[model samples]
Target: MTIRESKRLWMACGVGLLWFLLLLWPMLGIKPDGLEFATTFKVFGYVAVAAVFIMFFYQVKEAGYLDSVGKPVKGAAGALAAAYEKAPTWLLLGIVMAGAIVYPLVTERYAHDVAISVLIYVCLGLGLNVVVGLAGLLDLGYIAFYGVGAYTYAILSINYGLSFWLCLPIAAFIAAIAGCIIGYPTLRMRGDYLAIVTLGFGEIVRLVLNNWMSLTNGPNGILSIPRPELFGYEFRSLSSMYYVILGLAVVTILAVYRLNYSRVGRAWEAIREDETAAELMGVNTFLLKLLAYAMGATFAGFAGAFFAARMKFVGPESFTFLESAMVLAMVILGGMGSIPGVILGVLALVALPEVFREFELYRMLVFGGAMTLMMLIRPAGIWPAKRVGRRSEEAE
Candidate 1:
């Protein structure tokens, strides 16, 4: 073998060993009350064997075997896309909608819960897609608006005895107002600075929710939020709730898909591509951006209210910065500007972890590895937005 290849092999081995050592102590060594040296050594032996297999896999992957396997997958994906483009749009939509409507019937309660969670993230991802994917706005404080909606519902339900139907629009409106408040100040900012500002805003909101005991009940959280009801029939069953979220998810998908083809969506895309050029061309860049923020926040608000109603609780802990990051990751991984891609990303990220719950501790590690591999193999995302061939004068 060449020296370069030899070095790479050793490097892979070193990485596997390091991972084994670092993960071993936490995975098997630490006990609730004390160290478990015997268990640690036993697990270490298993990990060592696994490491060898991992090293071999990495070496073979480096040798391009994975690429050869991936070639057919890529070709299949291209063929699928071609087929989708040629299919009747209404037929495709009908098929998808029908499947979504029946998903709760096919899955068990646990899987239904996971599906509900996935749909929630799908909604969140689609919302953030408007701000980040369409308008190119980096919003790390998006979860703050989500919190706004959740808390709005939680507070209203707990104090005023308002129904879910009543609180839904109110929560959304509050969140949209919060979005406008944040968007106005950051209208001229972009890139890393904008990200930092949003991050700080998110932390600030979390802190407020944590410390404001008088209004929010602080870290204890607000609980006993009512679920949605129709004609006085409460949605008490898991399947019913699943169907509720499923319906909402469908509405969100349709709305976002429509927006993507609308004039407003085109304006956002123009802003994403070149803010200065769009402004020079007479696009109301400020107003359009605010609208994007409001619209995205509006969806997040809806999801948040649904989450509150579904879980019947709202806490500062639920609206962490990591939640925002995960939503953003879903948007980016799915293909930043592609709706179907975002849905797939949410399904993969949310459902796959649950599917492998036997290896709970290793799930994050595996997920991170999978994401890294995806980035290396498909940097543009699994379903990147198609670039428009030519912009019409009206579109510009």
Candidate 2:
């Protein structure tokens, strides 16, 4: 690296470290009885030392001092990619399915719970992927559909004593209707305006759930929701529930995969790239956008129905804006428009918090920091989707 660039790098690192120290001290050093610096400095020292080491190694790598080690690593990565491309699709899918089938048998109940959560989010992520990733619709209130589905199942199961299997499609249908309702008014909006309308819609749903005493029980939440039953057996165990969600997730994956390569998927992509051009080319931007919302919300409804069945409850708090953001984050972080990427993102975000549960108060702190680092290091995502063609500058 050039001397000027080296100096600038170190300067930026120094400033960042100072800023981190300032933020860290106020949080850790301020106590109830008195202010203290010992604990704060101790933690800061560890962070500062680690940062310095990382920067030093980075600088060395940039200077080509690690070329001998880097070259082999890069070659190995390329070979692995080539091998992956050559592998049969069924073989890869079989391996994944086998692992999933065995997961509950190998892990404890808590692990099963986390896995269930991951699978549920996977469904949500893929559903949202349809609108945000493919159609370029920025939906901030997608969780409202989720809530709709959950409440649909909850109400049906409790009031009418409907079976979980029967309520599933019913929930999906209701959520799809909700999606169209929300998507209709936002048809003319785009970017920030669309986001604001969706956000409002989501909050409105939450408020209704919170205040609708007759239907939602005013946040007391519905209870005694029956578990899903197949034939004569009820899914009352965690392992059984895991399998249920696993099947649902697989269905979601298949449906989304088909849509991704279909004519509708191409239309969504065209609309995403340039809505005006898509319209000029005879694409029905209006109906397709509404379809995107409905399709996306359908999977969410499936997930929500399952969620209500598993939890035996549905409440306004569960469908908060934060939940919507997290689902969106999973999509963006994993690689929008990629099914596998969404699943990986779901696993990372859902499992990481469980893994760091021992950290107690610092759990979210570590999670936020990791997300920021991931964004900075790979802004496109962990595994970005492959587009049809490259831009002119990129091709050049």
Across 337-375, the per-residue lDDT of candidate 1 in tens digits comes to 899889988988998888899988678877887899799
Q: By TM-score, who's the top model here? A: 2
All models: lDDT? 0.88, 0.93
lDDT of 2 by residue, 1-396 (tens): 999999999999999889888988888999999999998899889889999999999999999999999999999999999999999999999999999999999999999999999999999999999999999999999999999999999999888989988899999999999999989988789889999999999999999999999889987988888899999999999999999999999999999999999999999999999999999999999999999999999999999999999998888899999999999999999988888888889988999888878766667767788889999999878888899878998888
lDDT of 1: 0.88
> What does candidate 1 score on TM?
0.85
Lowest lDDT sum, 10 consecutive residues, model 2, at 358-367
**What value of lDDT does candidate 2 attain over all alpha carbons?**
0.93
Backbone-clash count (model 2): 0
Candidate 1 Cα errors over 4 Å, as ranges: 1-83, 390-396
